[model samples]
Target: QQQVRQSPQSLTVWEGETAILNCSYENSAFDYFPWYQQFPGEGPALLISILSVSDKKEDGRFTIFFNKREKKLSLHIADSQPGDSATYFCAARAYQGGRALIFGTGTTVSVSP
Candidate 1:
């Protein structure tokens, strides 16, 4: 039960629209939830995160809505822009040791004109 899955290998969202990326995990022991946004040729950065104790988290144009019981979560990008085009990953911490994150397959979002 240690898996995180994401949908849409890639997406083309229009500017000003909201882009939604879906993620789900099967592991119930994971406590920490974090979403990383990566631009072309750049490392992923922690865009926003939520603990299992909470159901939602938000930061700037990014927001994470989680459902612990359903073992699911989603990333919402408000006012999508071309600059926002990138690959988004949903990660979780299962083990306390280093490299605890189990990342989703990832969703490449392309906000276009």
Candidate 2:
């Protein structure tokens, strides 16, 4: 139960539209949740996150809605724009071995004019 799954390898949203990205996990042991956003050729950076204790999180135009019972979560980007186009990764941590994080397959978002 160490798998994080994501859907839609790529998505395109018109400017001002909301971009919805979906993710799910199989590991119930995972307690840390973080969403990472990356531009082309750049390392992923934390965009926003929600602990399993919370059902939702928000930061500016970015928001994450989580369903602990379903083991699912989603990221919503409001006011989509060309500048917002990037690759997003869903990740989780469990303090195992103090190694690193477990990342999802990643979703590439394209905001069109």
The models' CA-based lDDT, in order, is 0.89, 0.92
10 residues in a row with least lDDT, candidate 2? 92-101
Residue-wise C-alpha lDDT for candidate 2, range 11-63, written one tens digit per residue: 99999999999999988888778999999889999999888999999999999
lDDT of 1: 0.89
Q: lDDT by residue for model 1 over 1-113, one digit each (tens)?
A: 53999987899988999999999999888888899989878899988999998888888989899999999999999999888888999998875667568899999999889
Candidate 1 residue-wise lDDT at 86: 89
lDDT of candidate model 2 versus the reference: 0.92
What RMSD does model 2 have?
1.6
Q: Please name the candidate that would achieve the greatest TM-score relative to the true structure.
A: 2
Name the lDDT value of residue 99 in candidate 2.
49
TM-score for model 2?
Answer: 0.93
RMSD of 1: 1.6
